[model samples]
Each structure stands twice: as C-alpha cells, then as structure tokens.
Target: MSYYVRERLPPRSTGIANRDQDRGRPAMQREVHLIGGTRSEAIRLAPVTLAMREAGLLQPVMIAAGKHTGTVTRTLAAFGLEPDITVEGTGNDTVEGTRTDNGDDPLLRELDELWSVRTPAAVIVQGDTTVSLAAALAAFWRRIPVVHLEAGVRSDDLSSPSAQEPDRRLLAQVASLHLAPTPLAAMNLLDERIAHTDVLVTGTTVLDATLAVTTRRTPFQNPAVAAARTGSTNRLVLITGYGSEAGGEPRMAAAARELAERHPDVDVVLAVHSGQVDALPGDSRVIVTGPLSYPDLSRLLCEAYLVVADSDGVAEEATAFGVPTLMPRDGGEPAASLTADCARAIGADTEAIVTAASALLTSRFRRDAMAAGNTPYGDGLAARRTAQAAAALLGLAPVPDAMPVSVPVLPSGAHA
Candidate 1:
C-alpha cells in the first residue's frame, strides 16, 4: 500500500500557513517514519524533524537504523532529538545494494518485521548511505512510499571507490518524492527522466543544521581543540578526512605540518578519523584529534579561518560559514563551493596543499576575497521547504517555493 500523493498544492509562491485549523492536534497521530543511521544523517535530518513539528503538518517517527549507532544517537541529541525506534544494524558499510533479498541479515529482517507490524504511510531516507539503501529497499518491498531527502546528487567520476553513487541511483527508482538540495541535483534527476513534478529543489539540510548549531556556541570537548580555538589572534586551519575515503592520510598530515611551520602565526588542526592518528605527522602545532560531535564540528567550522578538507569535504559547511576551503582531491558535490574565487581542489598531495595554503595564508586579501563570495547553498530555509514538500506528498500541506537558480553571490564590499 504505497502512500501516493493525496494532494498537490495550487502553485502559490507566497502564502501563509493555516493558523487556526487543526492547530492543537496531537503530534503522534500524524506519524511520518524517518530513518537515520549515521552522524551526517542525524545532522541533515534534524532540521526537517523540527520544521515538520513546528508547521503542525507531520510528526516524524525517527528510527535509528544504521552503523555508528552511538554517534548517531549523540548527534541527534545535539539537535534535541531522539529516535522513537532503534534498529541495531548487523551489516557493514561495504554492502553493495539493497535490491537483493537479505533474509539472513538481522537488520533487514528487523526492518521488514517492524513495518509489517504497524506499517508507516511513508519512509523518509536521507542521502546515499548503506543504511538508506537498506531502509528504502525494505520500504519498497512493503509497498511504502519512500521520500528521498538530498535526492538527485550525482558524482561524475565513475571510478570512485564508495558505493554512494550507486546507492543514490537505485534510490531514484523507488522514491515517491525527490527532495533535491540544489537546482543542479534536480536537473540530474530530470536528465534521468524522473518526473519534473516529483523533484523539488529544497537546498541542503546540512546548512540548516550548521546554522542552528553555530548559534549555540558549544564548548569543544577536546583539550587541544579548546585551547587552539580560544583567544588565538592567528589563523586556525581545520582539516578533516579519513585515509580510507580520501587516500593517504600521511600526506595530509605532512601538509598540515608544513603549513603550520611556514606560517609562524598559523596553527593547524586535523579533526581526524580515529584509525589514522598514528599515520599523521608528529608535530606539536598540528593538533590531531578524533572526530568531533556535530555541534562541536559546526562550531569549529564557524571559527575556522580556513578549512583544508579531504574527501570528507566540509566545503558546504565551510561555505555556509563564509569560510574559504581547499579540497585536496577531485571535485564533487557543491562544485559551486569549489569555484575559483571561494574554494579550490588543489589535488591531494603535500605540495599542492602547502602551495595553496601558503598563497591564501600569506595573502589575507586572497582569503578574505574568497570568503566574500555568496553561499551557493542558499538563504538557509531548505529544511522548511523540505518539510512542506514531505507533508504535501501526504496531503498535509502545500509545497513551498523552489530555491533560486545557483549564481555567484557577491557580498557587499566583495571583489570580482
């Protein structure tokens, strides 16, 4: 029983919300199942949960379903959220696709049984994670409408190592509604022959999460991070990535060390993957620490003078905070961020990293000029638009206005 679109709103660009009608309804009765299993999912989806609740449209039944259960829970908590249901997953991250029957897999079996007991009207899956693949497939099997958040993102590079590219492509097949984060994404889906009406550009929810968390002014837990961030007159360079995803952690570490050494006042911090700590350069100035909680990470991004991101690219978040970022490898999503004026893909190596950082560091004019560019992500109401679209799919509300086409946002007093 797939929950098809009950009603689509009359095309209204500017309209007010229903103020008095059904204003006092209890939230639980309007259950909308949303699945999350990773920190990124939690961060991206938290704002949507809030928007839906505030709008009195749909109440999300957040189901914790993925690897990194602990991190996901903590990340959700930061956004004042907790999963209504937690499905302890048994599969690894390397699972190819969820198209096959995984009767033996405890995670898939659990999802199957859960939905069978009390089926949801729809299941909302975020991004292209293995968790999303499993959950989307399970929902499809049960004839549940799947709403794919952050839909239509594509990587041009076919040789990429991860299964993310394929996961999203498969998701496009079953999702009843596609919430594309940008116009480019919507175009990607349209190019694939997805119905124009099915795709909506909602901007990226990650920015919503970033904006909300930045206002909180959370304290950094890592002593090194805390000390480095506080009362520092010089620039703070924040680097993040996993060697497994981006390749050669050691080179990134070496680059950080070199950047720190060359610039007397500059300090480098690598909010690194746990496994790759030993592989990094052994330098006192380069503060290497484990992965940060989402809030802390957002705070660091806000405070960062410059961001040196590997494949676990923070360009979106960095760009959101008006921070200049340098991607160490080939460009991917949010290519607008990596444009010449703001961020750059300097090729993943020690020399490229050092050279780029040096250019930006020595020339404050260069760094400030880059940061002056407008955030290609949008004005930061992505979650709100997404909430409206999701509710509209279920006949709860009308669709919100689409985001503007992507263009260079030149801040006041910015250079060409």
Candidate 2:
C-alpha cells in the first residue's frame, strides 16, 4: 500500500483522464497528502483518512519525520488505514537541515514523486504548521489543487505573542478549498476576498473526532482514573494548553500551582503537552500525566470537576463533554461569552486562578446547568462527511446521507 513517487513512472495521463471522461466522472482515484509534525497533527489527519477510505478514495500519503512520523503512523494504525506513502528527509531532525535555500527538501521531493506517479486529483493539507505551508507550495507548483482544512482561523495579530497569523495568511492565499469550522470563519475568508464558491462551513472535523472517542465505551479503565476516583473526593481541575516555547507552559503551571496551594481539598492534574512534559513541576498536588489517547483523555475530562486550558479547541471539546473550563481571557472579551457558564477566563495569576476555582466549587446549581448545556459538537460522522466532500471535489461518486454520526456516551471511567 506504500509508494515512493521518485522511483516510479507517472501513471498514463491519457488513460486516467479518458477513464474519468468515459464514466462521466472526474476521477475516483485521488491522492491525499498530509504534512505536519506532531501527535495532534496525526490525530487530526486520522478522520480525513478515514473519510477518504469510507468514500472509496485512495489512502493518503503522509510526509513527516522523527517522533512526528511515529505518532502519525500510530494514529493511522489506530484507525486501520496504513499510509500509502511516507516521506522522510535526512535533515528532518533540525529546522535548518530540513530546509533548502528555496525551501524545498526531501519531503517536497517525495511529494513530487507521489504526484508524478499518481497524478492525484488533489492534495489535502491541514493546520498552520511549516510542513503544511511547504506542502501547499509544492502542490501549487505542481499545478495540483490543494484543499486546506481548518482554514480561515485568524488570530488577527501577527506580531502578537504566540501568533500564527503568518501561517494563516499564507494558507488563506493558497488554498483552493477552505474548510472552515464555523460560519464566522467562513466570513473571515470571504472578507479576505477568497472565492465564495471555494469556502464550506463543515463545522469542525475535531468535533467529529471528539464525538467518535466519546461514543465508545469499554470497561477497561486506566490507573489514573482509578486513582482519581478512589484517591479523594477533592475537586479535580484539568489543565491543558498549547505547548509552544512561548509563555503558555509557565502560565499553565503557575495557575495549577496556585490552585493547588489555595485549595488543599482540590487535585490539579496537569495534562502536559506531549512536547513539554519535562517542563512540568514536581509537586504531589499537581499530578503530571503523559499525553493520552484521545478517548482516554476524553474520559478524564468527564471525571474532571473543572478544566483549565488556553487552547480554544480544548475548551470547546471540554464544553462538549460537559466539563466547566477556565480559559485565559483576551482583553475585553469574557471567556464566558465564548463558552457560556460552563467556561470562564481568569488571570494567569495565582490569586485569580484560585478565586475562579473557589467560585466554581461553591456553585452546584450553576455547574449542573452548564453540564446540561453541553451537547456533542455535532454528529459523530464527521469522517464520513469529510470523505464525501473530498470525493465530490475530486469528482468521485457522492456518498448518501453523509451527516455526522451519533453515538451514545460511554459509562464513567471507561478507557481504551
């Protein structure tokens, strides 16, 4: 199922094109390439791959290296789709080593090889990572259409701390199709003058991923859940955030420590980012857990009394799970407005975190209401929907009733 594009001959263009024309179709056989370097990227790519497979499209080719590749391969295996091609470069370990003067590298070389061999109808790139940008450029150079997932997300301030504005801008300009998560995101693309015909508000594939994990129930529980349940009746606060070298880690740690100190009866679990686990503090009250599988992590969220994170997506997922969250507020906009009573924004200071934690601990009625307000982000069938959409774009047969899949929630403490 794997391929090396550089080593193979290009498929017969006349035959492929005529095949589509004869069937009064575009092309059923398409190639997808995902570019990124993180466990999160791997997780995000899974649903797309699943969607493609369910829609009868070709399995995707992944371009990544080092730990990132391993994580991606593992995620694909978890969903039962082996990559058709995996591209890794010699200098992939270092940023400078991986980049040439013109920004082309072994990864791009592999992509070129894949394109030559398959003549794929399109390529799908997700996120705002360097790999994605590079892949998009490569695809554009090759004259292949590119679909951008999670497009139209703008932080608005490129120079602001921890801003991904540049990547967002670059993606907005190059993407042929923009799969926006919300209507607002779609509007952002429209204001930027992107063709309206190219933008689609498909909710978020992440919500589909979240719902998929939540719907599955198993009796096997991890030790962490057992400990959390039997250890004490103390309030549980789950803290997560983006793990960039910016102030994200320190801010989360300081908040966790403050919550622990101010509320002795509470247990603060810091779900450290997979990249920054070593940076966490050594404190009994602040329990450190490794990066968990998505389903396992969702179950942990269900057990939590409150969740604290700076990530908007995590905050959204927490709300879907009915867990109240404390997010860092961007000046002027209260976090509650974005997430309802189930969520709030607090200062990174110890006093601010402690105060917010104390208030949530005391408000039983409010907590109950927020929990009730939580609903699955969408049906669990995002994978199928995305697959059908990508297939249609590629001129494949349309899948029927391609809506979100709905699944029942697992019992408390269920684990993979």
Candidate 3:
C-alpha cells in the first residue's frame, strides 16, 4: 500500500506541553520533520531547530542524509545538535537537480516507509541540493506539506553548468510555504507566479547561524587561524570556492600568486575542494588547506582582515562578520554584499582580484566602515520568523515571548 494511502491516525501529542482548556489535558505533539544531507544545509538549518524548540511549537525532527556526511556531522556538532534520525546515504554529489548515485533511491524508499509509520505535519528542506530535491519530492509524494527555507534566489539567467537553477525551480513549485531570504528572492517567486501570500521575506538562516557563533564569542579553535590571528604583521585573507569561473583552482592559483608576490605581508588561505589541492599555487604565503569545519571557518571569518571568495555562501559569512569581501566573479552574488558596501564584485581574473584586494588592504578606514554598516543580509532572527511561519502553517502557536520582529525586505531589483 502507498504510504499516503494508509489509514490516518490521530497524533498522540501536540508536543507543546500546553494545557488543553477544553479537554483539561496537554495537547499532542505535532511532528515536523526537517531533512538535509549537506554541510551548508545543516549549518543553515541548525538555528531553525533551536528556534522551533524554543518556540514550543511543532517538534523539529532533524534527519541527516547525503554525500557530505562528515561535514554535516561536524556542522550540527558545532551547533550542539544531534540528528534525531539519519538516513543512510553515500554519494559525494552536491550539485542541485542532480544525483550523485542511485543511493538516494533507497533513501526515498526509507522516507516512504517513515511516512507509512507516522505522517508528519510538514517536511522542511533548505537550499538547492540533490538531497533537498529528493526530500521535497518524497514529502510531496506522501502528501506532506513541504516548507522551503531560503527560497527564491536567482542569477536571473537560465543557463548554468550545475542543476541548481532547475532544482530551485522545481522545489518552489512543490513548496507549500516559501521562506524567501530577500525581497529580490521573493520577487523571483512572484515573477514565477507563486502567490504573494505563500511567499515571505525571512532573511537568510546563514546570518542566524553566523550571529549565533559571533554572539557567543567563541574562541579561535583552528590552529591555522590562531596562528594567523597572532601574526600582527600578517593580514588574513580567507578564500573559498570550486567553480572554474568563480572558484576554479587555476583562478585561485593565479590570484594567490599575485597577492603573494605583491603583498608579502598578507596571508592568503585558500580553502578549496580536497581534490583540487594539487592544482593550487605552491607558495608559503598561500596556506592551502582542506575544507574547514563550520566553527573553524566561523572563527576565521570573525578574525580575518579581509575575505576573497568565489562562493556566495562564503560571501554571506564574510558579510555577516562585517569583513570586506571580493567576489571573483561578476554576478550571482547576494544583495547584502553590495548594499552593505561590505563586498566588491571583481571579475574572475588575477589582476582584478589583486587590484581589489590591494585597495581594500591599504584602506583600514574603508574596511572598518564596511564592517560597521548595517547588515543588509539579516538581523539574527530569521530562524524565529521561520519557526513562526511553520507554526502558523501547522495550526500551532509559538511562544509569545519568542516572536520575531518584522524585518524589512530589500528594494526589488537590488540583486537581480
């Protein structure tokens, strides 16, 4: 029998622990399933889990599954979270709208079995990844409402190498609630004919995660970062990426070479994909390392003098910390980077990178001013807003004291 066809059973508890006036009993818990398989998804979703717990709303059941299992494990650990359930998966594919292996088919089967066991009020999926697409599809098939977090991002162009565009498009269509991270993103959904009532500008959860760590004032945990922190004469420039146009190791190598030769006082740290390490510039000034743990990267961002990255996620992180960033590509950057004057979009070339870095490095006043500007990305309450939205959808009330303040959306066309 199809899982969706099973006889529906009344929930045992509301999980709220609140007294039911009519029945003079505590309500039953509403099971809200959150599924993710990648490190990025894990990092962004951790805050939402905390917010939901604090809100006394639907119970957030975290399920970790995907190729980047180790990274996912570490990110959740940094947030002091343990997954309630973990689906067995083994594929290294991170591209959206594409599967790494047939591994996810079994995962889909597992999800079906789960739904057969107990239907959840909703399933939450974040960002554009293969696992996200699978989770959304599986939940939709089971007739469970799919809440899409960080929805409606667009490069505005259809052509792309990866399946990110298609994955996002499909997920939006099936998503019962769209949590757009920006007004521009909301506009993207609206343009696609998604109802305005269903779309909301909640800001990016990444900012919430960033704020979580920064507020705690976590000590520097990575030795490389700590060494850089103590080197008063060595300015730290954190770099990350994998795309050829944006993060290609060749491009990273060129930029590293130029910076190392021109600015010997700066320490350039290139955090690249493990496979591409052999392609990077062999320079002492360029500290080529494997992928960093979430906390390590957070600490590096907190203390880095400047950030030069090709990935949008890294840009968001740097902007959150008020660190100046130089995007090595022309487009596909978040609006906050430009609006906050915290980042510059430089074409993916050695000279453009070198020029931008040199200018930012020489101007201490400029960097400080960028850091002090209002964070155009978020105000550290996205997770709360997200939880509240989910609660409304599930017919559950959130804790009144933990309600989120209204966050203004950016003007349309800011990043399109």
Q: Write the residue-wise lDDT of candidate 2 on 1-416 in tens digits.
A: 22334333224343234435434533333455666555666666677776765556654555553225666666655455555455654322324213223444565566565556555566777766656766777677777778887778776767743225676788788787787655556778999999988877665566566655556643314565456546566777887765432566666677777777767877877777655545345556677666666666665676677787766667656765667677765442322225335567677655566677667767777655655543333344555665666666766645334232233222232111
Candidate with the greatest TM-score versus the true structure: 1
Clash number for each model: 0, 4, 8
lDDT of 1 by residue, 71-97 (tens): 777889998987777787664475332
lDDT of 3 by residue, 83-196 (tens): 776676543364442335544465676676666565677899999877888888888887788999989987755566566787799999899999987666788999999998
List CA RMSD, all candidates: 7.3, 5.6, 6.5
Question: What is the TM-score of candidate 1?
Answer: 0.85
Q: Please list the C-alpha lDDT of all candidates, in the order they appear.
A: 0.74, 0.60, 0.72
Q: What value does the lDDT take at residue 43 in candidate 3?
A: 87
TM-score of 2: 0.76
Query: What RMSD value applies to candidate 1?
Result: 7.3
TM-score of each: 0.85, 0.76, 0.81
Order the candidates by lDDT, highest first.
1, 3, 2
